[model samples]
Target chain A: MSYMISKATSVNKALDEAVPLCEPVLKIREAMRYTLLSGGKRVRPMLCLAACELVGGQDSTAMPAACAVEMIHASSLIQDDLPCMDDDSFRRGKPTNHKVFGEDIAVLTADALIALAVKKLVTSTYFGVSPERVLRAVLEMAKAVGTEGLVAGQAADLAGEPMSLEEDKAGLEHLEFIHIHKTAALLEAAAVIGAIIGGGSDEEIERLRRYARCIGLVFQVVDDVLDVTKSSEELGKTAGKDLIAGKLTNPRVMGVEKRGNIFKGLIQTRWFR
Target chain B: MSYMISKATSVNKALDEAVPLCEPVLKIREAMRYTLLSGGKRVRPMLCLAACELVGGQDSTAMPAACAVEMIHASSLIQDDLPCMDDDSFRRGKPTNHKVFGEDIAVLTADALIALAVKKLVTSTYFGVSPERVLRAVLEMAKAVGTEGLVAGQAADLAGEPMSLEEDKAGLEHLEFIHIHKTAALLEAAAVIGAIIGGGSDEEIERLRRYARCIGLVFQVVDDVLDVTKSSEELGKTAGKDLIAGKLTNPRVMGVEKRGNIFKGLIQTRWFR
Candidate 1:
């Protein structure tokens, strides 16, 4: 299997382990699988695992952080696919979480998934890391998901949802902030958090931050490219949805040449394992 | 000032002390204050203060958790008010976060605020409780916010966003979960977290939980009644909005006789300080 597939499968396994027992509610089980098992690439969770293993740790210890990162990512997607957020019909070659599950269950499922991830962090880290470190991680992750990070980006993204050319076209900074925060912050958190849990030094952690930043930008560029280059049949997510949504993407920023240059420069630096 | 007011003010003061040196992004700050200072009843944070005091502790150490509860609460509100979610145009007599800050900034601001609150929990708890306890507090708060708690409720709520009478009809059970998880769970966390920070015994913590549950339910009940009796001109939040939104409420559940009974029973209880 390709590294991505293996990593994604293991991350899915790790996520299964990390997900708390759903309250045996029909709604929860249905909604959760709708989003989780819909088969998107588990890129964020893989980042956590790769970072953990890079520093000589395993998913056994890093699983909670991994799950937390993915949960935040997944929750964002569930919301993103909502008729209000992204409103795209398909994700990972399947109907979006809200579309399949209905909106009420969709929102609740995302909320529950986020809760499960955080709870796991508390439980797993309790015996593994120093209380202070664990506390720090929880706080850090929370902040990562907070208003300034993904949520803020999401709000901004949603604000720009309708996509009038006159407005969003000029708001490139706004769109970048949204992308960086909404999508990349959680990805970065997975890596940084994995390093933290794996006992990487502060300097190592800083390097990992740079690593995550590099990959985050690269990952997003790849996404922008994929969204444009791929067909809806080629990419699970709707092709060119960003353009349709009027998202201020790098491609949208500098067009084909400039965006390609940035993507190439960053991707060559080896963010991927 | 009422006890709630004094407690809220004090927590606000400590929040100033405990928060990181905010460089102050204008959009972010505007979004934060637009809701935080918008004259909330502060019942949740007040529960934290009362719990801290009740456990013979001071507000100095409980500040972060107090602020965190409020931040968490605020983030949820922003999410809850999304066009795909509750779809409310106004909350507390003001335009909802998305309506005012515009969706993008409002969402980002709510997110940033939540992250800041987590940061507070990490740093703030050092003054009183152990780091482990602070982590524990954060874990609890996360659980409340996510699926099993508020987020799940929200998902269910959103699922019902385009409700038909044939569906759950905002059933009493569903609404109970919504209100409890969305409101009471956090309130309970604020209470227990304050006590834990104060070094309360397990017995005291249990007592606080019971107290929290009672007051939380009472608070929700009062809110339900207020939706009927109070005018939006005075209450800020529009009256009958719950029904308009198809919420499963106490009035809808218990009818007049049972509603009055529940309220009376709560008022006579010793849960309130």
Candidate 2:
């Protein structure tokens, strides 16, 4: 628990320095800082930092990337809450970015964060990591965010109802697709980038990649369960949105008990052993 | 003219290949393909290629980055035409992206293009450019797209009435600020990246950077004039949008004739000489 706290603390500090409020464009910067520095669990950054340290890389070498993953996450959250997208009013117990910053600024904020995220990773070379690894990590991060990753998942999620009604094998595949691309891909990329930057061998990187993928799926499944079981106040965002919107989720398609068992089974089978 | 045709031809072919409209997320892919393949003048790619060749870099080496500049440009256009932004119905004589794809997909299209642009530059190593150079080019592109560039420009452009009211020196400064960041930065980055990829010396890269900056500003100023002088049929977009939106353009700040002379003077003094 202390280790996690230390990692989150450093990640927050790095994020603050990365996106200073004092800027040539103060309003947009405020919007960016509002969303980015808003406290989440910092799970993605912790994964990135842990993977780097596990592979013998110094924290400084990976700190920029850890911050970058969080930036991407923030960008995604802002976009997801936009009126045209998920249309949620709140996130992390506060008004969504679009609600606070207005729609235009909110849209630009997401874009700026994405550009800043890529810039953060590319400039990470100053820490003495090889340019080749940095380039690879950039490619990985891009793929995780682009069509093959989050974009695809979000699109699928938005094209709800038709697919959600199918409780067959195809529905399971669709659900898995959404979870993997929308949630797991960034998590997987975070760990993979950390390992690559930390001088891990190809074998080690692949192992970490697999581990992170499972964890990402597990994370989404748990989130799905929480959306079903918790209230809006408890969850810090609008809960039961998935059910109300008729969006597909593990609990919805496979039953809450079954989904919980699957989550438990994966955890015990993969991590404990 | 033939040289321009050749460069644009190769760029078109490369762009088609880079964004293949295949399965998985067919809708998003279609939206991406629609905007990306839609005909533009291809000026940015031409400048990127010209800069590369001038620095003795092969076309093959810089084609990916050249395509990347266009992708970023396309992303900006999509976002610029959003209902909350410019709110234009027509772009390049066709319906804007959001008009065709709906707002949700349109937003995702811009995002996917950005990630793809970064991906394209990062994977340019296959053309044998050093990873160091690739990393540098990526950083340049990111900066051009982020707060210091397009995002900043658009933000200022949106806060229109207040800045537009200041037709004094400060207003001119504001207009220049918007033009440089919104328009010129990407062009400068394009030329700079080309020079870097083509293995130009720092001095050569800096020279191209300056040249591209001037050209980019001239492009916007001319565009502003055309908005006033031409009809929608001639300009291929909603003509007089700047006037209608009260957008701070060159013609709005300075008389059309004065802006025209400035454009003519720049051409005669810079390129012709």
Candidate 3:
């Protein structure tokens, strides 16, 4: 926990310095900062930093990629909360971005953050990372968020809500698709980017990619379990949201006990490895 | 016109090949292709290609940058037409993206296109351009659309609408702020990216930047003029939208004749030079 906190603090500081309220678009900047600064676990950045350190890279070398993943995460959350999408009013115990800034500014805020995330990676001159590596990292991050990544996952999740329980169970393939693309792809990219920035060999990068993918799936399974067992207060979002929304989740498909076992098995396997 | 048509044809082919309807996200890809492949002037890409040629670079080398600017332009237009933004029903004599795809899918389409635009530049391997140049182009393009660029211009444009005419006129600096950031910045970036990809020297890139800035301003000023003077049929968007929306425009501040003279002077100066 302390290790994660220290990394989160560093990521937060870098993020704070990254986006400032300035002229012409102070409101959108404020909107971006509002959601970004709102506290979360900063799991993506932590994973990125961890991957960099695991590969024998300097922490400073991976900071920009770490920040970039967090920004992408924040942008996705903002978009997901919009009236046209998930329509959630609260996130992390605060009013969602669209609720505070109105949908127009919220949309702009997401757009700006997405662009800024890419720019941050490309313009990180202070780190002296190779341009080729940075370019690869940017590509990884981009692929993670585009139609083939989070967007597709979210879209599939939304499209699946109206399915009957039997259909959903039969649609396990589709469920895995959403889980892999929506959640795991970005997390995998986060680790891969850190490895690239840290100058990992291709073999090491591929290994970390697979490791992060497993961790990401475990993360989602745990999230589904928590949704059933925890309250909104504990989760910092509406608990049982997947169930309420009729969204397909691992627990919904495999039953809670089996899901918990799967989660535990994933962690134990990774731990022993 | 023939020169522009040839450039547009090549750009269209490249853009069409750039985005394909693949698995898991065909809907969003269709939404993106709908807006992107929809016929427009392709002015930004033309400028990019022209600047590349002027710098003595191969057209093939600058193709990716050219397609990127058009993608960025398409994204801004999609976002601008959303219900919360310009609320337009039509663009270029066709239904706006949201009008066809629904707001949720439209938003995702815009987000995906923006990410893909950056990815296109980063992953352009055929040209053998330096990673440093591509990275610089990506940064330049990203900056052109973020808080300091299009989003800023858009936010200011929306905020200025409710102001009294006198207040808006008093805010001419603010109006220019919108024009420069919203319009000129992307155009400037387009030329800069072209020059960068084409391997122009610092002086040449700077000159192209200045040239594109002038062209962008003239473009917006002409747009405002056409909004009032031309019919909707002629303009392809609602005529007098600026007046109806109370949007601050060059004609709104300086009067149509003076704005026309400014546009003429801008073009004439560039032509003579």
Candidate 4:
């Protein structure tokens, strides 16, 4: 936990310095900074740093990639909270971006952040890593956020809203698809990119990718359990909102205990290794 | 016009092949393709290809970057026509993206396209250009689309809506700022990137950049003039729509004839040189 905290602190500082509120577009910049600087667990960056260190790399070597992952994550959250999407009014205990900046600016804010994330990765001259590796990481980040990854997961999840979970064989498979693409794909990319940028061998990168996949699944399952068991206050977000939204979740498809056990088992296997 | 047409055809083909409708996110992919494949003049791509050729580079060398600029342009148009933005119902004689797909999908479609644009640029192996040049082009594209460029222009444009244009020095400066960043920045990027990818000297690149800046501004001024002078049928889009929406434009700042002369003078100087 302390390791994660230290890494998060470094990431937050870098992110702050990276995206300042400059002139001409101060409103949109503020909107972007408001959401990006909002406190989260910084799990993705932590995972990236951990993967880099596991492969004998320093934290500075992975900082840009780490920051890029968090920026992408922030942009995703901003879009998810728009009135056209999840329609949430609060995120991380603050009013959502659209709620504060209006929908037009919120949309632009997300777009800017996405562009900035790519810019940061490609333009960062401090990489102790090679340019080819940096380019590969940029490509990986792009793929993770596009139609083949997060957008695909989101589209499928929306389409599956009408599906009946009870007595449906395809429900479990569909749920897995959503979780894997929506959650695991980015996490997997984060770890793999960190490893690549940190100069890890192809085999080591492959191993980290697999490990992150397991961790990503466990992260989603735990989220499902928390959504069912925790209150909105406890979770720092609207708990059980997924259920209310008629979205398919692991705990809803299977019992909470079973889902919890699966989460625990996956975590143990990945972490112990 | 024939030269532009040939370049447009090649660009359209590359763009079509770049973003195919695959599984899992077919809906969003369709949404992206719908807007992208719906034809435009492909002005930015033509500029990129032309600049590349001017610098002794082949068409294939600049194809990916050309496609990328168009993708970014398409994404911007999609977002600009959203309900919370310009709220336009039609673009290029077709219904806007959100009018066909829901607003949620429309937003995601734009987001996906932006990510894919970056991906396409970085992953293009046919680049006769060096990796450093490709990376520089990617970085340029990023800055062109982010807060300091398009978003800044957009936000300022929106905010300046309530400001009275008469007898205001700031209004003219603001209008120029908006047009320079919003329109000229991407166009400049397209040409500069093409030149870089084509292995142009620093002097050549700078000259192309200046020429592109002039051309981009002229393009917008011509658009403003056409909005007032041409009918909807002639323009292939809703004419006088900017006036109705209370958006600031070049003709709105100056008279139509004055703006038209400025546009003509810009084109003559840049092209005839």
> Could you say which candidate leads in lDDT?
2
Q: For model 3, how does the per-residue alpha-carbon lDDT over B74-164 read when each residue is reduced to its tens digit?
A: 9999999999998998889888999998998998888888878988887555688898888888889989999878998999888985455
Q: How much does each candidate deviate at the interface, measured as C-alpha RMSD after superposition?
A: 3.2, 0.6, 0.8, 0.9
lDDT of 2 by residue, B54-170 (tens): 999999999999999999999999999999899999999999999999999999999999999998987679999999999999999999999989999999989867444345567
lDDT of 1 by residue, B85-187 (tens): 6677878888889888765465456556656766777776568578767776777777677655666655554544434444444465576666666667777
Q: Pairs clashing in candidate 4?
A: none
RMSD of each: 4.5, 2.3, 2.6, 2.5
Best by DockQ: 2
Per-residue error (Å), model 2, residue B264:
7.3
**Tens digits of lDDT, candidate 1, A174-194:** 756776777677877888888
Q: CAPRI band of model 3?
A: high
Q: How high is the lDDT of residue A127 in model 3?
A: 89
Q: Model 3: per-residue lDDT, tens digit, A115-186?
A: 889888776556888888888898898889887688888888777754655764476678777877889989
Model 3 misplacement above 4 A: A22-24, A261-273, B163-169, B264-273
Candidate 1's displacement at residue B33, Å, is: 1.9
Report model 1's TM-score to 2 decimal places.
Answer: 0.85
lDDT of 4 by residue, A14-57 (tens): 89988876555778878988999999988898888888898998
Cα distance off (Å), candidate 1, residue B171: 6.4
